[model samples]
Target: MPFADSLSSRSPQIPCSRRQALFGAGAFLGLAACGQPHLDAGEGILRVIGPWDLGGFDPTKSGAMFSRLQIAETLIESDNAGTPLPGLATGWTTSPDGLVWTFRLRPAVLFHDGSTLNAAHTAWALRRAMEPPATLSLAPVADITSQGDDMVIIRLTKPFAPLLHLLSHTSTQIWAPAAFGPNGDVRNVIASGPYRLTRFEPPLRMDTAFFAGHRGGPRSVKGSAYMTVSRMETRTLIAEGRQADLIYSIDAPSARHILADSRNQIIAAQMPRTLILKVNSGNPKLADLRVRRAISLAIDRQGIASGILLDPSLAAGQLFPPMLQGWHDPDLPPLGRNVEQAGDLLSQAGWLREGDGIRRRDDQSLHITLKTYSDRAELPVLAAALQEQLRLVGIAVEVQINNSSDIPLSHRDKTVELALVARNYANFVDPTISVIQDFGRGGGDFGATGWVNRPVEQAIDDLLTHGDPDGRRRRGIAQVLQAELPVIPISWYMERVALSDRVAGGVSFDPYERTLRIADVRLAGGRS
Candidate 1:
């Protein structure tokens, strides 16, 4: 009686319905349909390729693998277009007041271990994530109670417009209670995903198997094997040898070299991540608004973006990217390369050029340390470019490359002079939460100089806590943040994923990096 069986019984071998087929092919019918998919259970592993090693399987402590890797599924889900859809919850409805939400569970759906997925199980998972240790943001339920039979009602203290987006995130992923130990700690992951974890070795490889219990449409890749090759050269080698079905994280030159081979396919995606310079505006040396404006003017964003990143359009003029539609205002004044204006501003601010040609104030020379990291591969190069560009403006800067985590740690210690790091703004579908978390008073993990404008802060709070459609207050807040430039952007980054021409029917990229739906991805048999 379940929808899965109803759909399955009608056509077990077909992946799409007549409506879908018509939409895709415009009513054209094939002379002969494809045969039943022959999946060899022993060799049924679909090899997936990525960069990070599968170190942590637990979804709470480390969710990179759990969320990005799609090793688990959340109650509510999002389509490739980022539209809110259903996962474990077949359907949902809200009260007129919009404070309460009730979701209906899919019938007869079972976990990999053959346990039925019910309202009780779903509620338990939500409760666990809401507890102190996990502190998941999406678990906004003050209380959750099962409905008469198959439904679950969630009561929230307030209406959260982005709650559905939070549900699609990894922290809300559902897991069998038995997957954890008596201490309520996760030791393993027995989840309901397109792929299930079969073999895992810490900091190295993760091999996944197709879930036989999956009741979704036909998938091309029934199974997949994921392995991490850290060294860029090694990753290239793997792709060259066909040892890796797909390769990622290689530099521009390396990617170009790999793409030259006729046997491989290279895919480039505009990653919703921005490379920014974080400054401490509160520091007396940097407090003067003129100093901030002068430094912003001095940095040649176009030169750095093109010369160092090999992309001209990546040069940023504002804090947020064009892809972040709602918050980004195209009407703002353009930031361009202006060395003469920078020099004039510094001179007017009383920072005169001394005999040594370095700008000086009293006995102090204009020198500072710029901290960066080599992890992302391009940052150190950009840092070097920045060093040269800043020095040209009579500002002496020294560069240091450390671990990726050092940026935030240094910010907390107040030891960081200026930090150059990449931020992925697409983590949350709605940009408001990220903006608030980063720019609010005390600042969140990634912001610098504790940038706080009371008006901007209040505007964001109004949008998050209480704001209706056509919220001019939210727009005003974004405009203020843009004008102030809490975090100065150097360039917007694009992530590259290299795949062997053997794979087909896979979506290009999802900015959230959530799931790569491989069902339609089939191994190319030399030709389409």
Candidate 2:
């Protein structure tokens, strides 16, 4: 994927109240705040504000964003509970041997570029998805071939239970043949979906309109305009002013503030996401299992959840929240703060508290730097709380707030000691794959660094091979994590968005955290 130059078009960017965003001056920002449409985008456009920006034309990079907007789709789609639904691929079947699977495509589907979707093009897209760096590469896919104009067959090295579920990911989104260049690099986004791209400017703005050729609308909305607003403060003002129909990733403080506005409401849902401390286990100070355990024991999850996040139950008892059935084990002991126990553990690890109240083993100090990003709004605050809690146990911490992307970069370069991250396990079909990718073997960008447990690794392989119907394998992995404390779980996440009363169709949330489903909503009193 080469550099994607900025896209220029006549479509308008959704403005903010600050009037100083990359989207330009917000002269028409709060027009809809008064419950009326402005001059340009009309009453039908669903204007949205959020923190994520389009990475590029590369499907592997920014495909999830396209999926969230429903501008492009994958072969298979999933409901809130992860049940497979028909998208481009209407139906599929596995070979009796389980080594091969065939998918039947939906008939008469038209790409945005007026190209017909067939088995060949779909296979090409799937092959691209299997390339390195994409999530699909983790699967056992050997080859993808088109048997005919409508049927596509996938051959795997071995049987994978999550094959269909893997295809549901946006990375497998099929693009029109014309979307690719002669060198096979993705030049643009041209796919079959409910909407078509009207304009796109990387890192800031995107605009869309209903594709009349497809069989989707007369929907509640004709189109949507998205703008990346990184600051929670500016986003809250935009929502309070009704500048956007939907504003995503609102902070806890902003959510409580929005409740006071009768014309607006907070739309909240349980997300399969957990806030954890991404520990650099390779660091000499954190190498000992006792040191890591002491770090976990010192932090108070209950206090942080109640005071900072505003929900006591959100203080995660375990990494797997209750909503994540099969993964969440009730019998496992909950994670609680114990300062005396933490001090004891530190002493056992050869770290003795000195005169300055900071633990040190001779000259080596029990000190660490915690990296965090404000993308989720609660993470920086949580980092601060963790710092104070660790200080009580003579563990000194310095919190450094930086961009979310830096966490992965620092992890790769071995420069990060500890990072505060909110990880979404449901980004894939299930948490099973995520757990493996994160904590398995060599470790993932956001998972355990320089830490490996053979039993945990073996458990993941067992789940992959035999499939954990009773979740015995998953519980075993959890038990090891509870004892080892690779990454300390802080709290579970409830994805909250601030929506105006102007939005209709009940303001339902996509439990999968994929799409906002703007197509489902309309102006309060307007007909669909």
Candidate 3:
């Protein structure tokens, strides 16, 4: 049952009238006037605007870049409904022993450079992903080889039930062999997706054009331009003024404002994420289970969810949200604020409240730095709220808002006392992969403090190696791990996407907030 065994694994559009006419503008513009934007020659190009900066074209490094994701297609893909479907590997089957998997590549599929999709090329991508000097966070393959012209076989040291889900991540996306240099470094950046990257601007914007020769032939979308505008007001203005065809990463207040406007239509969906505090359980002051339980009891999740989040449904009753149907236990006792009880627990633990309103044990004040990042636009606010909440229970907390990478950096340095983060459990459609990275051994960027649980590890391994599709046993194992206080989840997150009336069909929201069905979207005016 070792944790390693865990199964698992844009806005905007400008109307280009001339471009439309060249394609079919005269006919499509009439329909485009209906606020639908023409899908033919007369229609306009899609201008997408959002908050995620395009770090780079590297799929492993820059997750928010539509430029990268649009070009790179992974082995598996998921819809907004959270169902796992085929991607580059059109079909796959697992060995009865559960240690090997065979993937049947899509025939007639070609990369941007017109390279045929073959087993050898697919194997090259897999092998390159496993090699060092490249950090494709979700690479789980121990080895990969071509079985035939269209079949690629992957070998695993142990069974990983969530393997497919991991493959669905953009970080593990498949790129053409020529895309990388001899050292496995990304060079040409050629991908086999429905769209090809035409231009890339670091940490900001990207432009892509439809790959008509794509296996699926661009599905529904013709072409798209993605922009990274970190400022919320900018995205809002663009959406409202009809400058942007689509937008995302809006805060609750901004979302309400947009939804309130009659002209703009906003779509809000439940994101598979949580606002949780990762406690360093190994710290002497927090090592006691009673202390962790007491801290959990001292917070008012309902108040935070309703008052701060402006969404009462986000108040998390358990570590795992209800959306995670299998791993969440409906029967677990709800953690609620009870200051008196918390005080009593603290007193019993030999901690006494000082005159300054901070708990003291053995001459040490109960003060800790709660680290957070502002990339999400809400973590800092939540951290401030948590600061006041914890203070009510005699715990003094200092909030330090740093860059997103600092959380993992601090964790590695062991300087992090408590880290407030928004963890996305649906990154791979299965919770086990996250469980392993976050809770196993030394803990990943968003897991427990200097704490390790052997029993939880074994349970996860068992579920990965032998659990059934029924998922009950795996659920039980996840619940046991949560009950151990490895990570404390306070509120769940819901995904939100903002769209303009002109943008059509290209809009689908996923739990992880990833752009998966980009092909389904096209310019309002007909120009595909």
Best-matching candidate per lDDT: 2
* lDDT tens readout by residue for model 1, 69-173: 556888877754457888888899988776899989878776767677778778867777776545354435678778755687888877766667767667778
Candidate 1 ranges beyond 4 A from true positions: 1-44, 132-135, 138-141, 471-474, 526-528
Model 2 residue 284 lDDT? 90
Candidate 3 stretches with Cα past 4 Å from truth are 1-44, 63-69, 79-83, 132-142, 218-220, 522-528
lDDT, candidate 2, at 456: 92
RMSD to true structure for each model, in Å: 11.5, 7.1, 9.1
Candidate 2 local lDDT, 327-436, one digit each (tens): 88899999898999999999998999999999999789988999999777688888888999999999999999998899889988888899999988888877888898
Taking all chains together, each candidate's TM-score versus the true structure is 0.86, 0.90, 0.86
Q: In model 2, what lDDT does residue 92 have?
A: 91
Give the backbone clash total of model 1. 6
Residues 1-528, model 3: lDDT tens digits: 001111111222323245432443333244358654421222444667666666765556654454234777778877655577988778999998778999998888888888877888778776766544343334456788998889989888777777777677666777777888887777766888778888776766577777877867435456666766665555555555565666776666666655555556666666668889888887887888778777888888998888777788888878788767777777877667788888888888877898988999997998989999878777888898889888988889999998989988888888888888988886666677777778767788888768887877777677667755787676666666556676787998865556666665436655655563566664454221
What is the overall TM-score of model 1 with all chains considered together? 0.86
For residue 440, what is the lDDT in candidate 2? 92
